[model samples]
Target: MIEVTNLSKSYGSTQALRGVSFRVESGEIIGLLGPNGAGKTTMMRVLTGYLQPDEGQVTVDGLDVLTDTLEVQKRIGYLPENAPLYPELSVQAYLKMIANLRQIPAADQPACLSEAVRATALTDHLTRPIGELSRGYRQRVGLAQAILHQPKLLICDEPTASLDPTQIVEVRRLIRRLARHSTVILSTHILSEVEATCDRVIILLNGEVKADARLADLSATTDAVLVLAEGAPDATKDLKALAGAENVEAYPTPDGHQYRVRGAGGVDLRPAIYELAHTRSWPLRELRRDVRTLETVFNELTTQVRRTSADTGEMKAGRRGSDQNPSASHLSERR
Candidate 1:
């Protein structure tokens, strides 16, 4: 389990994190999503004790990260965006080095090595030099090293970057498997990976927490119906007039006009639409509740944040200009 509260970090004039906070329960796979420069990596570093936050607190299993840095590091397995690996060392040798670095007992090294290799499917590539393996295999090697110590928490940043479709799927499956043994905090630009592998998601933007919720709750549909009907052009307008219908928007389709009918709270417009269609003899092609995908939700949140930041920047600029000249303030207010 992990808890971060009001975590803030800065690099000179740039604030990489600003009052970001979240909690992760044991055995949960959480996706950390954001655009570039979103402070995901900064937060991970702070959590892993690689970097100390300028303000706020982080605790792992009730242990303070700053005071118990070694213990926290011991409990975490980190695979950075670009995995740091020894090119000349064979996979087996690399894992052995990691086991020693992680302070695994000499007696337990073999079992840990075997388990990590087996779990990551690196049995065949153990004897091969890491430099000779493909990118996908190299990523497996990275994962094997991370789990070689059986850490309680796994932090993976872009674990599937630069891989082909098949490799991405393979890596995702591996992450899912890893979740059975360790809590996972995965950071990636891929939205589908979050949908496929994460139980919950935390979206970060401009160094702040934007949205955090279970994927199921975040993807829940509103009180709206998607209706596909083939009839007169006024069908959408008529549907808008139906009882409980609040808003209607038509989407172009080859076979019919697809209208999304939103209803007032607790209103069911489906029955009314069905009755209207029956009365008008219009052909109904499709009718179903509208559900938003993770992509849609992510875009909306991050875009809104971007617009807010732009507006704030413009406001600050206007205030600075007004401070230098009283006449400019009056003119700006008039505009």
Candidate 2:
């Protein structure tokens, strides 16, 4: 289990994380989703005790990451974006080195090595040099080393990045297998990865959490309706006037006009919409509830943040110019 509260980290003026907070229950697989520069890596580093937060706190299994860094490290296995490894060392030798570094007793090293190798499917490549292996095999080697100690928590940052489709599937299977023994926190930009492997998803944008919910909850039906109809010249205005219709937009289509109608307070406006269409003699081609997918939710949240940031930047720039030229500021004010 892990808990992070109001965790903030910055590099000079650039804030990498801002008020990020989340909890991971035992045995749960959580996916951290965000675009590049959205603080997914920063949050992962802070959680793993590799980077300290400037503000806020992080605890893993009730152990504070800052004060109990070693203890937390002992309970976590991290596979970083770039796996830390020695190319010169053979697979067996590298794992052995990690086993020793993780403080596995000599008596337990053999069993641990065997289990890790088996779990990651690296038993056949034990004697091959790491540098000689393909990217997929190297990723397996990275996974094997991370799980060598059997930590309670596994943190993987972009574990499937740059791998072929077959390799991605292999790594995803390995991650799911890892979850049987340890809680997982996976940071990836790939939405399909989360959909395929994660139980819950936390979406981050502009260094802040935008959406955090279970996959099931996110895939639920939206309180909106999609309608395809014809014979109404002012379909947008008519739809907006219908009872329970909160927001309405109508777009011209090849066959007819397509209307996106949002309901008020989770109300279903389908019955009222059908009644209105029948009274007005509009031919209804299609009427159905709109369902929101994970991709749709992700794009909506991230794009809104980008637009807000751009507007704020423009406003600040305008104020700065106005201050520099008071005459123009007065003229604009008068206008």
Candidate 3:
């Protein structure tokens, strides 16, 4: 439901996004992964039409974000790192106010408010002033407001930040529940949260898009193989001698041993391992490719990008001495 193409934005000398591009299909829980200054917040702002891009195009549900600014805003619900709230307003009043502000018709406001409250588990806390509620309850207030309009696109920046473990899980489940209808773009530093809630992730670095992929695909894309055998006594030594074998860890099991073998350059070590096991009369009970965790994939991609950037910076520094900001006229080219 959202498409961003070559979206570039900069602030004076600091570039926030550099030709970043990605697509979010409807009902997909997308985790926007990146370190500080990776342009995640900038991208979210551009998507919400709160900030215009210096370059590139963004469309939410087939409407251009730049041309249909107000329309896009109506369809997008943005919750910043710290939500903008009125502490003095009671939960009920705050939601009603947000409903009116979202332009929901007076006739439909009640149903919308009720649904938002029920979904966010704020029914019991509605009478309490926002300032009097605990941090979790306050976060619920933020979430309640964002979805009060039932927008098609929901952008949450650190929605669970500062929340306790129980609160974080509650908010995480709440986000998942909301994704049943709205497209979610979750930007948080918590990798485990991303793994738990997001179906896909887009990693950004140095104002650029580094990776965009489905969680399943990334998890399955690994060069490591798991080997479990009861009869393979000297399998570790033989496995290490195999070509392309990078690292082989052998741990003794009750019956025999379990081995984790990693290969180089996406090599398939299964065939060699199987052949050797057969030749050596090693009864292999389990031999399969290892699945990578989101953390592993994230670390690898970010590290590669940082290394390449460092190398390129050294070369560019030796030649140009510095970088230049885009002139307003230059930024206007995308317009």
The C-alpha lDDT values of all candidates are 0.81, 0.83, 0.79
lDDT of candidate 1 over 147-239, digit per residue (tens) = 888999999987887999899899999999999999999997667778889999997877888889899875654445444555545587788
User: Which pairs of residues clash in candidate 1, taking residues 3 or more apart in a chain or in different chains?
Assistant: none
Model 2: lowest-lDDT 10 consecutive positions: 326-335
Over 104-210, each residue of candidate 2 has an lDDT whose tens digit, in order, gives 99999999999999999998999999999989999999999888989999999989999999999999999999999999999887778898999999988767888
Local error of candidate 2 at residue 226 (angstroms): 4.7
lDDT, candidate 1, residue 64? 95
Local accuracy of candidate 3 as per-residue lDDT tens digits, 51-72: 9899999999999999999998
Better of 1 and 2 by TM-score: 2
Q: Assess the local accuracy of residue 154 in candidate 3 as a C-alpha lDDT between 0 and 100.
A: 92
TM-score of each: 0.76, 0.81, 0.76
Ranking by lDDT: 2, 1, 3
What's model 3's lDDT at 38?
Answer: 63
> Measured by C-alpha RMSD in angstroms, how accurate is candidate 1?
10.7
Best by TM-score: 2
Q: Rank the candidates by TM-score, best first.
A: 2, 1, 3
Worst 10 residues of 3 by lDDT: 326-335
Off by over 4 Å in 1: 223-289, 312-335
| Minimal lDDT window, size 10, model 1 | 326-335
Steric clash pairs (candidate 2): none
